[model samples]
Target: MDLDCFKAYDIRGKVPEQLNPELAERIGRSYVEVTGARKVIVGYDIRLSSPEIAAALSEGLRTAGANVFDIGQCGTEQVYFATSHFGMDGGIMVTASHNPKDYNGMKMVGPDARPISSTNGLLAIREGCREPLGNARQPGELFQIDAMKPYIEHLLGYIDIDTLTPLNIVVNPGNGGAGEVIDALEPYLPFEFHRVHHTPDGNFPNGVPNPLLPENRTPTSMAVTASNAAMGIAWDGDFDRCFFFDEKGRFIEGYYIVGLLADQFLRKTGGGKVIHDPRLTWNTRELVQEAGGEPIESKTGHAFIKERMRDEDAIYGGEMSAHHYFRDFAYCDSGMIPWLLVAERLCQSGVSLSSLIDARIETFPASGEINRTVKDPEHILQGIERRYLEEALSVTHTDGLSMEFQRWRFNLRMSNTEPVIRLNVESRGDIELMKSFTRSLLDDIEELDGQSLRDPQLSVAL
Candidate 1:
């Protein structure tokens, strides 16, 4: 009866107490009722509870007269791929991506693999799940599907394979689902892979799979340097987001990767719209324009970016959080496609990954993302906005409070699920200025809140 598992974008919470097989079944039946999806694609991640949860969910869908195409033990994007690729009416991926191992949840998408968030049918499904179940209709058929082959082929379509020469790359899945995908694609590529924590382990023996954490990056970074690899990549649990490291074992901030990917996508498409988050913009905007593509800014989050990409028919969309969305992949984010394209660029340009990113870093320096747990996020945000409103050359609220001055800019936003404030600062060809503004902003925030701030953690080095 406890349906607290439903969240703004997806269902995520502790197992059993917050989410269980019984509740999952109800959700499955409710999904069919709310969206009227006749045929649905179902998949799950590497969590231990995933298989049972997925099976119960399929039973509910079948009882509701919806045929279920089950893609077993896959990442979230695989469900997205299968749904849209097979022309299914909807899709559901059982995953608590990057969450603690004790938790399990689901991400759902409607027809064409469009996300179903609170604004759409998520709320309705939650409400429907609370009511008593009706008599079962004629049960629909269930079919096992192997979606990996076509999905892998679709990923290969992103770049010219013949252009890719042999190179060494380090891939750390962090004991998540990405290793399986890399294994599936290994034979088709020319690169030699040095894998770290490459198995699919639900226990997450090497800590949780989030590569965003500073500590989690050490293994991948060390391997890249020790093996003399050209580049390194890491993905979170369920592999929805991926992070990169250059030849020098230096972590490349996701902000820079957005710009790099935009440039690559634009070059291939000749010219198309590229959607980017507003948190860090100068680098992406400049590269997009130079590549003869329009740079469209969207509010942060996968749902908003995907919706914007659909509206604009964008060739690609990227968030500095490492979620890269491709127009061809049902506008869903993929951990696999990004590294492949980056590798292809490496081969074609004959330049190191660091070389490709260094110029961009110098042109537009950023503070990356700094997270601070504030006593009052709204008060802090409003106070900062009031102080900066006068001197600001421009202010935008695409996602949060973004103010631009003559030479530098900063964005301050509150976290959706916590009382944490995220800050990002950037300057036009000035790293020192960016650093200075970042320090000043933190000082201002603490002074306004009248509380000593916690030691802020930077998601990436300046």
Candidate 2:
């Protein structure tokens, strides 16, 4: 009865101990009981324990009188796509998403593919699992579905295929679920793909498929240079987030990609609201404004971004963490759409990815996201705020403490699940200024760490 798997956003934990087929089945039933979903879409990733867990979950769904559409072995987004594409009542994806091989978990969404987080019915579902429900009057049926075709077609609709010219592109799925998708889209596209670790392996031969790590990015970067590909793209285990590399084999920061995507989406939508996170703003805001699109800032995280997108009717939303949301795709983030749009832009503009991103990087130099482990994250956050609040031109608490000044800005936010605080600093086209402030902030954080230990009573309201 260990329900530690239930998280702020989704369920994720060590397998068998924290999560297993039994709990998964109970969760499936609980999902139906909480949401009253009569027709549910069930999908799983390429994890070793996924098939058995998914089958058990489907059984639980059936027991709860909810019919199950099993889209076997797909990415997390596929569940989102299948759920909304076929108008299912809800969907659940059995995936830990870049977690260790020994771990397994689930991501759930209610009607219209809206996420079922703790703020919604996730906690209620967790509670429901504690007390099992009796068998329903009638068990529901199970249907195996091939959502690949319609899903791929829907993805292709984002960009004009006719406009895409033959270009050499490097794609590294890192032995995750994205290779299957790339293979499916191969016949319809004009690009010559240099696929690295293209096979979908539950063992994750190349690693856990998290391209965000500096070590995991090496293979993709090398492949881009070795093959002289136009650009390189790498995805996480579930492929909900995708990281990019330029022709020169350099990893492009996700913040820059956010701006690039905002501009691209705005051009297509002919001036629509584009939502971005608060961490890095100058580049995205400037690009969005230049493209005649309204740039709206939302608190970081997929749920927050999607909800804001729904509220504002945004054409697109992006995070510096690599999740890109689209209005056409039911306000869900897609790993496929972002890359395709970038490739299309490359083809149309006849420019290298580096050329496009370099300009933006120069216009807005950022320190990227730097994480620091501290004794007291809250105290450090408050200490930093106290030091900077007096002269700050503007202060925002959308997600974290974001203080903006005349020439620079920084966001110091604590991690939800860890004792680490993440800091992001940026300047108006001044790399030295950005670097100087980043170092200064790091020093302040280091000093605050000691100060907090000495004076625990030093409290400042957020």
Judged by lDDT, which candidate is best? Answer: 2
Top candidate by TM-score:
2
Error of 1 at 314 (Å): 0.7
lDDT agreement of model 1 with the native: 0.93
Residue 230 lDDT, candidate 2, scale 0-100: 96
Write candidate 1's Cα lDDT for 80-104 as tens digits: 9999999999999999999999999
Cα-based lDDT at residue 95, candidate 2: 94
Inter-residue clash pairs, candidate 1: none
Model 2 ranges with Cα > 4 A deviation: 460-462
Q: Give a tens-digit lDDT track for model 2, residues 226-334.
A: 9999999999999999999999999999999999999998888889999999998999999999999999999999999999999999999999999999999999999
lDDT of each: 0.93, 0.93
Candidate 1 Cα errors over 4 Å, as ranges: 451-462
Give, for candidate 2, the lowest lDDT window spanning 10 residues.
453-462
